[model samples]
Structure formats: structure tokens, C-alpha cells
Target: MAVQIKICGIREDRALEAVIEAKADFGGFIFHQSSPRNLTISEASRLTALAEDRIQRVGLMVNPNDDFLCELAAHASLDAVQLQGSESPERVGQIRELLGVRAWKAIAVASREDILRAEAYADTADFILFDAKTPPGALPGGMGLRFDWNLLKGLDVGLPWGLAGGLNADNVAEAIRLTRTPLVDVCSGTEAAPGIKDVDKIAAFCKAAREA
Candidate 1:
């Protein structure tokens, strides 16, 4: 199957248009307050509405509360919610049930144990995202750092999963070849600066993943 692609951190019409033109499978909106890519509920709703029927929309949040999730759900049209913090399996399950949308858990992988830990979310999360673990006091993800792809070789977590962290046009094909990840996500990799996406880079990354 052709590798699916998700271009994350979209905050502008041009970026959203580029992702749609590139035909990426998903576009992500960051809802974390500290991140450069963070979006307001209003902003996310507008973007998500613009992307309706064109690309799947996902909201990325970090240890969000039930009230905030409910607020976001009332405003934006999201296909899934990506949990990028220390949410337990029960929390994940509750979020999935409460939102009535697919839930994705992002696992920060630096060692074999981290990858194995994904199995804990099999019953709750609809998808698992394997991303490189950032350093202490650093942002949770989108740091343009990558772990050893060999760690994912022959991985089977009994749930749909994707690969993320530091993927770009040049290395995406090789990343796919090594891990055979069905879906690949890019954030800073296709950016001109933090929270600024480059249209050409987005197109190139999509091409590389599809051709892989």
C-alpha cells in the first residue's frame, strides 16, 4: 500500500492549501499552549472547517482536561485527537468515548521498552504514533530529532500506527523502507521556521511518501 502522510502544525491558509494540494492523508492542529504551533479553538475550527472533505483533521493536545476537550469538540470538526502527554490508558479510553472521535496516542521511543509500552493502549487508542523522545525541558515533539528507525523493524502493536519525528523529503522514503510504517507524519521537517510551513517542502515530502 502507498504510505499515508500527515503534515502537522498547520496554522495558515497557504499551509492548509499546500497540504490539500499535496494530498496528504491528514493535517494536524496543535492545541498546546507552550508550543509555537499552538492554535486557538476558533482558529482550529476555521481550519478544520476549511479542510472538511479534503483532508482528515487531527487535533494534537498535551494532557488536556475534560472541559477543554469538550470545548474543542464543540467547535472543531476533528477526525482524531492525538494525545502527546502522560495520559494513562484509562484516560485515553475516556477521551475516546467522550469525544466520539478516534483517539491517537503518541509514544516517545528511545528504547525497546518504550515501543513495547504501546501495547498498553491497544484497547483504547484507535492509532499509535511513534515519535522520538525529546530532551528534558524540551517541547514534547516537533523538535526535528529522530530515533534509530531500526527499533521499529517488524513492530506490531495490534493497533494502527504511524511514524513521526524529524521526517523530511530526503529521508522519508528510507524511513518507510526501514520501518515499513503505513503512515508518516511531518511537522518541523517541512517548515521554513518554527510553526511556519514551506509549501515546496510539503509537496516534496508527500511525493516521497507516496512513491515509497
Candidate 2:
């Protein structure tokens, strides 16, 4: 099967339009205020309403509380929640128990050890999103940095996993070929500027990922 394509960091109606036109599998909304791609609940709600069943709406949060997650889920019209923070496995369980929504936990991987961390969350999360570990004080994600894909070779866990960070149209095929990741996600890879997604780049990334 072809790789599942996800175009993340969508902040506008046009960006959402671009992802849909490109047949992306998932469209991400950053709920963290620290990131430039961050979207308010009102803004995300407007865009979420425009989302169809063809694409999954993923709400991205960083170290969020129960109340915030509840409000975000209610407003964003999300199909899944991506926990991109330091949330513990117990917290992950709590989020799932409380909201009862599909949950994806992002694990920053810089080495094989990082990939092994998926074990703790495998049963708790519906999916595991593997992203590059950024420098201290850097952005939470969408930093366009990459780690070693070979580290994921022969790796197996209970939950499904997706690849992210520094992946563009050109290298996504190689990354997929190396890891054979079932799902691939891109943000800076498809953007001309931070928080500004280019339509052509979006199309190119999707096409390349599909071809890969």
C-alpha cells in the first residue's frame, strides 16, 4: 500500500484547501501558542467544519490539561489528538479515558533508544508519531530537522507509527524506503515560510510521497 500522507501545521482555509486538493490523509492544527503555526480554537473550529471525511482532523497540543483538551476537542472538531509534549503514559491513559478519542503521542527520536520509548505508550495511544528531537528552547515540532531513519529498521511495536520532521518531497521516498513507515507527515517540508504553506510544495510532497 502507498504511504499515508499527512500535511501538518495547517492554519488557514487555503492551507486546508491545499491539503485536500493534494489528497492528504491528515491535516494538523497546532494548538500550542509557542509555535508560529498555532491556531486558536475559534480559527481551528472554522477550518475543521470545512474538513471532510476524506481527511482526518488532528488536534496538536503540548502539555495540555484536561480542561484544555476538552475545550480543544469540542471546538476543533477533531478526529484525533496528537500529544506533542512531555505527557506521561498515565496522563495519556487519562486523556483517552476522559475524552475517549483517538490519541497519537509524538516521541522525539534522535537514536534507537528514543524509538524504544514507544513501548510505554503503545497500548495507550492509538498511534505513535515519531519526530526529530529539537534543540533546547527550539520549536516543539515542525523544525525541519531529521534524525537517522535506519534507527527504525526492524523496529516493531503494538501501535502504528508515522514519520515526521525534515521530510520533503525529495527525501520522503528515501525515508519511507529506509523505514517503510506506514504513515508520513510533513510540515516545514511543504512550507515556503514558517506557518505559511505553499500550495505547489504541498502538491509536490503529496505526489512524491504517493509515488514513494
**In model 1, what is the error at residue 136, expressed in angstroms?**
1.4
Worst 10 residues of 1 by lDDT: 1-10
Top-TM-score candidate index: 1
TM-scores, all candidates, are: 0.99, 0.97
Candidate 1 lDDT, 1-212, residue by residue in tens: 88889999999999999999999999999999999999999999899999999999999999999999999999899999999999999999999999999999999999999999999999999999999999988999999999999999999989999999999999999999999999999999999999999999999999999998
Name the regions of candidate 2 deviating beyond 4 angstroms: none
- Candidate 1's TM-score: 0.99
lDDT of 2 at 148: 90
For candidate 1, what is the total of clashing residue pairs?
0
